[model samples]
Target: MKMTDLILKYLSIKTEVKIPGFGIFQQKNVPAFYDERLAALLPPAKEFFFTEDFNLKDENFIQFVAKEKNIDINESYAEIAELVNYWKFTLQNKIVLEIPDLGTFYFNDEGNFIFKGKHFSTESPENFGLEELNLSELKNRKSALGKSLENEYKTSRNPFWWLLLIIPVTAIIYLGTQNPELIFGKKSFKNLKKTKTDSVVKSRNLLKDSTKIDSTKSKIPTPKLK
Candidate 1:
């Protein structure tokens, strides 16, 4: 069988297929998640990924190939080596190479090999009829969270409404100080208030007399004081 066919067959049954001096092809599970846009749960699925481990030697792979093909072990090793060398050469010269039913490989800017299509999961009997889940509880939770956030935002945007409670108290205190009679009635005070009022009136009268004298002196005299 061709190298690609053998690899595809091995990976169909086995979770990992190691290529000596190259890399390992292994299946991985994509984690499940809640999709807010769809309001559904996405089921986990299998995917393939490559790990380049040069130090790994897969004696079992060669043995399996040799036994399956009924070929000599030395011949199997030589064939595998030739295939690996061809792939490497193709990647280096053409910058990209595709393996049938396995994945695509290409060289990046640093000349490092990059693998794509590993996430293209194969359809297996296990996931043949899988379905996504629609969860009402999750939808309710999201709705509640949205409402809570909106309420918090509104409170923060117009927080000064709470301060309005103090406005009435402040106005009352100001009015009481400026016009105590409004709240306390006209007879609330008598002796001390009258004395203070008399002192203010006397000071105003003295200020008016002094201002009149200064104004008369500052004016120019008429030809004859009429």
Candidate 2:
């Protein structure tokens, strides 16, 4: 990866990233504020600035690069130094030094430094999904005591939602265990067992009645033959 890309990426999430002999990149957060004319609350935004008054390398920033590239600190230091020298050499030759996502850095004829930054949007898709909050809609809202997140959860979540998940899970478990009758309710299981028991007892009684009839017939037939 190019050094400029690495530096721009580092500046994206960090408050300050300083490279030796290069410069310092800093980020400032502009808080959300109300727009009186629009009657809406503007979202918070980010601002970036560059400074070149210092000549010291930031070890923490170098370490971040080291970790990101999965390299040792020595390699990281060498890479940063090479990039810094390239930027300086480019500027010294009166060539336009452009860093993508940031802006351009160039020296004027009078030995003065100038940084021209591109404007970044603070709107939807890039604004972390924040919307322009309209306060007029809140005029009729009643103030409540609980937290908004808590209230939202209480309203949006169903108290019996767990039952829906639990029922299917329990059925799967019972069926996996080869006991589907347990899933049908204890009363149904008991009735099924009782029906099997009644059928067996009726079969035994019928067998006994047939045996008694057979013995009586045998006793009467022997007398007839005599």
Candidate 3:
């Protein structure tokens, strides 16, 4: 297409383009890095730079232009030389020179020839589009993890569990400190109450037989003389 467009394409392909009397255009490599805000990995990229030294055309670059323009190499070289002179004349007389989609060439306050690329986008074709991290989903996962931990703590504990073992132990200790016969002997408080009731019944029966004293005396069992 246009000569300026061809210059840009050459920069993309060869990574450098040197124009007589203007400056040399070059591309810089920006390596991939992690982007914290997006929480994603960014791809390697290309950036532009310019210098005033070695403003000479490359043989392969000239050949590329010749092939693209469907012209001979000598014709291509002459056209490129004329374009370079036009760029230099514009910058020297008009105080600025603009190359469409490439950059603007001008003298800075330091009287240095400088190039600033137009529409300087850092987007690289090597990138596979990645979505940004969702903060809401991250917070939800954190809350769920906290709830899981709480449930696990609750499941591992029984509030009244100590009572199950303590009650039996306390009862055993109290019984040990008291009379052994309460738990192991037949003549305990239950046996004493039964004995008292039996004695009272025997006395009542004796009173009922007071008029039959001789019958009662004969009924009593006695041991014979040894």
TM-score top scorer: 1
Indicate whether candidate 1 or candidate 3 has the larger TM-score. 1
> What would the per-residue lDDT of candidate 2 be over residues 1-226, giving only the tens digit for each residue?
6666777688777777888767788776656777786688867666567887447756877898898889999999999888788878887777888878778877778877688654344654546866667887665343343466677788657757767878999879978579755665545343444368888999999999999999988884445553
TM-score of 3: 0.45
Question: How displaced is residue 219 in candidate 2, in Å?
Answer: 99
What ranges in model 1 sit over 4 Å off? 32-43, 109-111, 119-226
Measured by lDDT, the strongest candidate is 1
lDDT of 1 by residue, 1-226 (tens): 8888888778778888999987898877775666686677766666678887766688778987898799999998999989888877786686688887777887777888888644443465566656677897768889999999999989876859657867988888988999987877798456664468888999999999999999999999669766
Query: Model 1 misses residue 166 by how many Å?
Result: 68
All candidates: TM-score: 0.47, 0.45, 0.45
TM-score of model 1 vs. true structure: 0.47
Candidate lDDT (C-alpha), each: 0.79, 0.74, 0.72
Model 3 misplacement above 4 A: 20-22, 30-45, 54-57, 122-226
